[model samples]
Each structure stands twice: as structure tokens, then as C-alpha cells.
Target: MRTAYSVETVRGAERELMGRLPEGALMQRAAAGLAVACGELLGRVYGSRVVLLVGSGDNGGDALYAGARLARRGAGVVAVLLSPERAHQGGLAALRAAGGRVSDDALRDIGRADLVVDGIVGIGGRGGLRPEAAQLARAAWESARVVAVDLPSGVDADSGEVHGDAVRADATVTFGAYKPGLLIDPARERAGALRLVDIGLTLPEDAEMEALQHADVADLLPRPVPESDKYRRGVVGVVAGSARYPGAAVLAVAGALRGGAGAVRYVGPAAEAVLAHFPETLVHPGPPDKAGRVQAWVIGPGIGEEADALEEVLAAEVPVLVDADGLRFLSPQRTRERTAETLLTPHAGEAAALLGRGREEVEAARLASVRELAAQYGATVLLKGSTTLVAEADGPVRVNPTGTSWLATAGSGDVLSGVTGSLLAAGLPARDAGSVGAYLHGLAARRAAGPAGAPILASEVAAHLDAAWRDVTD
Candidate 1:
């Protein structure tokens, strides 16, 4: 697991470490690690031109001290101080003593440099780059290979919000722990590649966010055995679709088939259409209560405002996935009454309805919304969009990396519900089922739409699920 801490947590950790060591020790350690990384980028420390975009805080101090290390190694290093008067005195002294030069004519000479280090703002920064800093960052991005310290300047280290103009770095070198902003979208895209350096800071157990590494995902995936029979593999009951939208039923079944479920029992008015499309599916034209025994249940998809359908599924004694239209009729109190696990998958629009907020409001603060939904309903929440977020009731949230804009097509979400439901039926934990299912769903979409931008149908995405699973596991 790749954990992310809040800016406050990082600052507290830095302060604790600073107090335990001698004066200037922590900053020196950060600077030395940064300098080594810069050296690797330049191939050789000697004869390389290095430019530092210095800010007013300790962030600028880190850059200056790192630049000093390069200067001592025979590299031509220059510091472009954004706030010369407020810059860290100790760091500035170290840089000058090591033969590094300070220049105000940085913009004109910046293009000639081999690499640029953005130390304009650390975790303390609130908004994007200030006007002057923004101008410099834009220039550096256009010409030089940029490396960021701690995080890219101008991004909200806590929320991952890019207020205005932010630095887009070729690589970001973080210390101690990852920041939530770096793992999330918008700001995540700006952070090209990530590197973590241990500065011996102990993180709190209550960190807010996390990302799953390959090994973690591998451990979470379900493994089948030779003794597993059709029922033993798990049976999924799907209560989705209506007369108005029968296609959703077909797409949902398509995803369920790709999942490792042995059988699917579908109950809805669209049973005839589902049977016609997928003859293997066992269709029942009845209510959810009489749908028979299933290890897990998937509800909502194309279901309109049918309160009976929603209530029946909610009362089930098995793990349940409530998505799309099912989200409309859900009540937190009702969800809490259930004995089995409940998972909620809502796009921004549906999430807004559940929270009684605007769609834009939910999108802008997706992290908060997902967490709030989890806390409110006492269930795992999966907020789907550009950056799909999965938050457990009392655990750290996870942001999925594999996604594309093409997934916005209609019925894609329905497929996701089915796949996740099947995983739940196969006895996987709610969090793992939701996260892994999302990863597979996104990869399948990418595979279906090849390099030439082939138009992909929802069924085609389901067809590629097995290939995606193999790619990830292999």
C-alpha cells in the first residue's frame, strides 16, 4: 500500500525530526537527497547547468542547499530567488559558500539550463503559482526538464486541487510519505513520475488516503481451485433494468459473465431481453425477494423509480451493490439496518443527489464527497469519474490510476456494477471487490478501444475483461 498523508501531518513530522537532530540537519538531508537525484538526471554533476526557482519558505531553502551541493561538484548552479529577502538565511549562506551564484536575470538564462528544480512552494502552499512564479514555471516547462521538491509548486498538497497556474514536472521527489494530491487526478497528471525518499519520519496510523501497489492488488485478487464447482465459485443475483432500458440488463450480464462468478440469476421486467441477449443467464420475471439464493446481489443500473425493487434488494442477507438508479431510492438509515455488506457506486451526478449538492460541487471536491458518503451510509463508496475513488467506512480512501475519458459512454457504469457484484459474490472483501473491479473495468475499456481510436461498445469492454485480468496478474 502506498499511503498519503495530509500537509499538516508532513509538517508535524518534519518538526518532530527537526527537534531531535542538530540545527539544519533535516534540511541538509532533504537537500542532499535532492542533489543526488538531480545528478542522476544530468548524467554527470560537472559541467551541467542547474537553475533553482526559489520561493520565500523552507521549500526555497531546500532548493538553495541542493543547488549548493551541485555547485561544489563543479556544476554551474544559479539560484533565481523569488523572495530574496525572506529566503532561508542558513540555506542561502551554504549555497554562496559552495560557489553557487544568485541572479535576477533568470528567465533569459533559464532556457540554457539542462534541468530546473521547482522549490517555489512545498506542502504549505494553498493555490497555484503566484503571477511571477507562474510565468517562470511556464517557461521552464516549455524548455527544461523539471524536478519538483516534496511536491510540484502551486498544487494543493492536501486536496490535490490546482487553483490556477501549477508547475508540471517531469518528476516529483517526495520525502517521508506521499501526499493525497499526488495520487489524485488533475494534480496527479501534472506529476509525471513519482519518487519517494525516506527521511525517517513516522507517519500516523490515521492517514487519509492510499494507493494499491501491484503486490497488494495481487494478494487481494481471488484465486480459484480445482475443487471449485459452479455454485462454489459463487452465484450472483442481478436486479437491474426496466422496460424503458433493456440494454442495461444485457450489458450488466456481460460484465457478470467476465467476472469469476459461476452463475448469474437476473430478476427484472427485462428478463426476456436479457435471456435473448445472453442465453446462459438464468432470468426470472419476478421481484428481488423471490430471486432465489445468491452469494451477492447487484441492484439498480437501469431501474427507474421502482421503490419495491430497491427495497427488496436492500433487505437481502448477502453483499449488495447499489448503483445508478438504485442510488436514487437509498436511505442511510435503511442501509444501516442490513446485516450484510453494502457497496455504493455512484457517478458524480448520483452522488450529488445522495448528498443534496450540485454535480459541480461533488466533482470539485470528490475526495470529501466519497469519504462523506462512506461515513454517512456505513458502507463502502465508489465515486466514478475521471479519477475513480473507493472509500471504505472507516479506512483510508484509494484513488484508481487506470482510466480514460472514453469510459464516459452510456452503460459503462452498469457493466462496472455487475463486475463488482460478481467479485463480492466470490467472497472478496467489499473494498477489494470495488477497487479491483474498477481497475479491470478501466483496462478492459482501454483494450477495446485500440490505438487507432476504434469505437468500442459496452459489450466489447466486457469481452476484454479476461485479457485485462491476465495482463495485471501476469
Candidate 2:
């Protein structure tokens, strides 16, 4: 797992580490790492024209010290002090001693530079950039490949929100540890490629956010033993579809069949459509409880307004995953009353409706919205979007790293709900079920999209799950 800490947590870790080192030692360590990363990006550091957009913080000092290293290696290094009066005195003196000059013609020099370093702001920065800083950020972005110190300027280090006018780096050299903003978007989009330089800071084990690698996903995936039987592996009950949306039942069942569950028992009005698509499914009409004993129930995907079955499924002692129209019937009291685990999967519009907030508000503060929903409902919540987030009431939120733009096609959410529900049936915890399910679902979309990245149907995403599972496990 690739974990990220909050700004406050990172500050605490940095302070602890700095206390153990000599007076300028921590900055020197950071400067040394930053210079190496910058040098590698520059390829031939000798004779390369480098410009540093120096701010007033320690971020500026890192750039200045790094600039000195570049200057010592025969690179023409120039520091454009955004705040001349407050720039690090020691760093400035070091640069001057190494034959690097402080230039006032920032824009003119930036345009001709081979590489530009962004130290305009650090991870501690919030809101939009100041006017002068914003101008320099734009100049650096348009003029050359920008390398950011710690994090891109003006991006929220905690929530991953980007205000107006921020620096766009070709690469970001983050010191000590990864921050939450670096893994999420629209701030994540601004942070190009990421490189972490360990400065010997010990953060808490329970980080604020995390992204799983293939190894993590592989560890979470359920595997059947030779002694396993149909009931032993797990049975997932799916309650979905209506006359107007029969295809949703088929898609959900398609995803469930490949989710490592022993069998799929589907209860809905679209029994004929589901049977036609997946003959292996145990199909039934009417209430979900009568559909037979199930370890977990997945309710609501194109169920329309008929919420009669939603209430019955929620009453079941088994773990339940509520999604699509099923989410409409959920109440905080109803969810909290249940003893079993409950997972709510909602896209932005559904989440907005549930929270009584505008879609724009939820989209703008995705991290906050998802966390709020999880606590309010007292259930695990997976907020679906370009960057899918799985947040429980507490603990680190898992950000899914694998996905493609092609997943925007219709019926993908239904597939995701079914996949997650199957994992719940297979005995994974709600958080693990949600995270691993999303990891596989997104990887399935990437497999379906192929190298061409052609547009694909939701069924294609479901069809590719086996390949995605192998890609992870193998």
C-alpha cells in the first residue's frame, strides 16, 4: 500500500525528525535529494539553463540550495525571488557563492530555460495563488518542464482541491512522505509524475489516505480451495432491474459471476433477461428474502421506483450493499439500526441527492463529501467518479489508482455494486470489499479499453474481469 499522511501529521513527523538532526541538516538533506531528482530530469546538467521560482518558505530554501548544486555542476542557475525580502538568507548566499545569480527578469529568463523549479508555494499553501505568483507559475509551465518542490503550488495538500491558477509540474519531488493531495484530483491532475525522497520521518501507521498496488489487491482477493463447495465459497444475492431497465440485471449478474463467489442468486422483475444472459444464475421473482439463503445481498441497480424489495433486503441479517435506486430508500436510522455491515455505492449525483447538497458542491469537495456520507449513514461509502474513493466512518480512505475514461459508459456502477457485494459475501470486511472490488473493476475497464483506449460498453468491463484478476494475481 502506498500511503499518504495529512499536512498536520506530516508537519509533526518533520518536526520530530528535524529535532534529531543538526541545525541546517534537514534542509541540506532535502536539497540534496531535490538536486539529484532535478539533475536526472535535466539529463545533461552541465550547461543546462535552470530557473528557480523562489518563495519565502523552506520550499524556497530547498530550491535555492538545489540551484547551488546545479550551479556547481556547470549549470547556469538563476533564482527568481517571488519575495526578495523574505528569501532564505543562507540559501541566497549559498547560491551567490556558487556563481548562481538572482534575476529580476523572471519571465524573460523562464522562457529560455531548459528546466524551471517551482518553490512558489509548499504543501502548506491553501486557496488560489497570489497574483504575482500565479503569473510566474503560468510562465514556468508554458516556458519549460517544471519540477515542484514537495507539492504543486496552490493545490490543497489535505483534500486535493485546486483553486484557480496553480503550477503544473512535469514532475514533483516530494520530501519525507506522500501527501493526500498528490493521490487525489483535480489537484492530482496538476501533480504530474511523483517521486518521494525519504528524509527519515516516521509517520503514524494509520495514514489519512492510501492507494493499493497489485500486491495489496492480490492479498485481499479471495481464493477457493479444493475442499470448497458451492455454498462454502459464498453465495451473493442480487436484487435489481425493472421492465424499463432489464439490462441492468444482466450486467450486475455478469459482474457477480466473475467475482469469486460460488453462485449468483438473482431476485428481480428482469428474471427473463438475466436468465438469457447468465444461465448459471438462480433467478426468482418478487421479494429478496425468498430468493434463498445468501451470505450477502446487492440491492438496487435500475430497480426504478419499486422500493418494496429494498426494505426487505435491508432487514436481512446478512451484509448488504445498497446502490442505484436502492440508495434512495436509505436513511441514517435504517442503516444504523442494522447489525450487519452495509456498503453504499453512489455516484456524484446520487451522493448529492442523499446529502441534500448540489452536485457541484460534492464534486468540488469530493474527499469531504465521501467522509461526511460515511459518518452520517454509519456505513462504508464508495463515491464513484474519475478517481473512486472508498471511505468508512474513520481510518485511511482508499483511493483507486486503476481506471480509464472509457468507464464513463452506462451500467458500470451496477457492475461495481455486484462485484463489491460478492466480496462481502466471500467474507471480506466492508472497507476491503469496497477497495478490492474497485481495484479489480477499474483494472477490468482498462483491460476492456485495450491499448487503443477505444470506447467500450459496461458489459465489456464485466467481461474483462477474469483477465484483470489474472493480471493482479499472476
Candidate 3:
């Protein structure tokens, strides 16, 4: 797991480690790692022209020290001090000793630099870059491949919120643990490729937010056994679609077929439509209670305003996935009363409805909104949009890394609901089901799009599920 701790946690860890090590040791370690990274980017340290955007904190100290290291190795380095007086005194002295110069030349020699190091701010920064820093960052971005110290300056270290003016780095070299801002958007979007440098700081136990790695994903995947029969794998009951929108039912069933579920039981008025598209599906035009036994249930999707259908699914004892129309009819009281594992998959609009907030509000702060929804409803919440976020009722939030903008098409969410429902039926926990399902769904959409860039249909996405699963499993 790739863990992301808050900015406060990182500072606490830094303080703890700083107390144990000799004075300036931690800063040296940070500078050494940063220098090595700069060297790698430069290809050859000798004769390379490097510019450092110096700010008024330890971040500037890191850049100045690293610049000194590069200067000693024959590189020509210059530091642009935004705040000359407040700049790290020790670092400035070291750089000067190593032949690094501070220049007041504005755009004259900046565009000619080979690399630019952004040391404007670190985790301690709250808002966007100060006026002077922002101007320097803009110039650096236009000229060189910018590398950030700690994080891209001006991005909220805790929330990933980009305030006022921020530096968009080509790559961010972070110290200690990954910040939540590095993994989430809009700060995440500004942060290009992220590189974490271990500074020998031990994080706290409360640091729980994380991103799933390939190995962790592999371990959570469900596999079939030789002795396992169809029933043994698990049965999924899908209550989706209506006379008005039967296509959702077909798409939902299609997604469930690839979920490693033993059997899929469809209970809705759109059975004929579902059977027409997927003959393998066992459809029933009866209520959810009459759909026979099932390990898990998928509700909503294209379901119309039918209180009867919603109530029947709610009464079930198995794990339930509520999506689309189900989200429309959801009440705080009903959600609070849910006994079994409940997973709520809501797009920005639906999430807005559930939270009684505007869609823009939900999208702007997706991490907080998802976590709030989970806590409010006492269920696993998956808020889908540009960057999908899944949050459990009591655990750290997860951000999906494998998604494309093309997934904004209609009916895509329906397939996800079914796929996650099938995973739940197959015995994966709610959090795992939501995150893994999102990863698989995004990969499948990418594959289905292929080289021609064809518009991916819901069924095409479902068809590519096996290939997506293989790519992850292998």
C-alpha cells in the first residue's frame, strides 16, 4: 500500500526524527537525495545551468543545500531569493562557499537554465505562491522542466486544494510520507509525477489514507478454486431498470457476468430486455424477495420512482450496492437503519443530492465529501467523477488512479454498480469491492477504446473485463 499521511502528521514525524539525528543531518539527507534526483535529470552535473527559486522556509534551505552540492560538482547554479533576509542562513552560506551565486536578473538568464528547482514552499504552506514566487514559478515552467521540493509550491499539503497561485511541477520530490494532496486532485492534477524520498521519519498509527499498489490489488482479487461449484462462488441479485429504461438492466447484468460470481439473479420489470441482450442471465419479473437466495444485491441504476422496489431491496439482509435512481430515493433515516454492508455509488450529481449540497461543492472537495457521505450514511461511499474516490465509514479514503475522461459517458456507472455488486457477492469486503471495481472498470474502458479511439459502449466495457482482470492478475 502507498500510504498518504496529512501534513501535520508529516511535520510531527519530522520533529521526532530531527530530535534523534545530529543537527542538520535530516536536512543533509534531504539535500543529498534531492541533489541525486537533480543529477539524474541533468544527465551530467558538469557544466549544467541550474536555477533555484528560493523562498522563506526550510524548503528554500533544501534547495540551497542541494544547489551547493551541484556547484561543487562543476555545475553552474544560481539562486533567485524571493525573500533574501528570511532565506535559510546556513544553506545560503554553504551555497556561496561552493561557488553558487545569487542574481537579481529577472527573465534575462532564466530561460537558458537547464533545470529549475521550486523551493517556494513545503508542507507548511497554506495558500498559493506569494506574488514574487508565483511570477518566478511561471517563468520557470515556461523555460525548464521544474522539480518541486517537498511538494509543488502553493498546493494545500493536507487537502490538495490549489489556492490563488501555485507552481505546476513536472515532477515533485516529496520527503517522508506521501501527502494526501499528492494523490488527490486539483492539487494532484498540478503535481506531475510524484517521487517520495524517505527521510527516516516514522509515521503515526493514525495515518491511514492510502493508495492501492499492484500487489495489494492482486491479494484482494477473487479467484476460483477447483472444488468450487457455481453456487459456492456466490450469487448476486440485481434489482435495476424499469419499463422506461431497460438498457440499464442489460448493462448491469453484463457487468455482473464478468465479476467471478457463480450466478446472477435479475429481479425487475426489465427482465425481457435483459434476457434479450444476455440470454445467460436468469431473469425474474418479480420482487427482490422472490428472486431466490443471493449473497449480495445491486439496486437502483435505471429504476424509476418506485418506492416498492426500493423498499424490497432495503429489507434484504445481504450486502447491497445502491446506485443511480436508488440514490434519488435514499433517505437519511433509511440509510442509518441499514444493518448489512451497504455500498453507495453516486456520481457528483447523486452525491450532491444525498448530501443536500451543490454538485460543484461535491466535485471541488471530493475527498471530504465522500468521507462525509460515508460517515453520514454509515456505508462505503464511492463518489464518481474525473477522479473517483472511495471512502469507508471509518477508514482512510482511496483515490482511483486508473481512469480516463472518456468514462464520462452514460450507462458507464451502471456497469460499475453491477461489477462491484458481483465482487461483493464473491465475498470481497465493501471497501475492496468499490476500489477494485473502479480500477477494473477504468482499465476495461481503456482497452475497449483501443487504438482507434472508438467511443466505448457499456457492453464493450463489460466484454473487456476479462482482459482487464488478466492484466491486473498477471
Please name the candidate that would achieve the greatest TM-score relative to the true structure.
2
The residue pairs in collision within model 1 are none
* Stretch of 10 with least lDDT, candidate 1: 210-219
Query: Per-residue alpha-carbon lDDT of model 2 for 1-474, expressed as tens digits?
Result: 999999999999989988999999999999999999999999999999999999999999999999999999999999999899999999999999999999979899999899999988888898988999999889888889999999999999999888777889999999988999998888888889999998889988899999999999999999999999989989999998899999999998888889988999999899999998889999888678788999999999999999999889889999999999998888999998899999999999999999999998888788999999999999999999978999999989999999988999999999998888999999899999999999999999999999889999999999999999999999
Query: Number of clashing residue pairs in every model?
Result: 0, 0, 0
Collision pairs in model 3:
none
TM-score of each: 0.91, 0.97, 0.95
- CA RMSD per model (angstroms): 2.6, 1.3, 1.9
Ranking by lDDT: 2, 3, 1
Ten contiguous residues minimizing lDDT sum, candidate 3 = 205-214
Alpha carbon lDDT of each predicted model: 0.87, 0.92, 0.88
Q: lDDT (0-100) at residue 443 of candidate 3?
A: 86
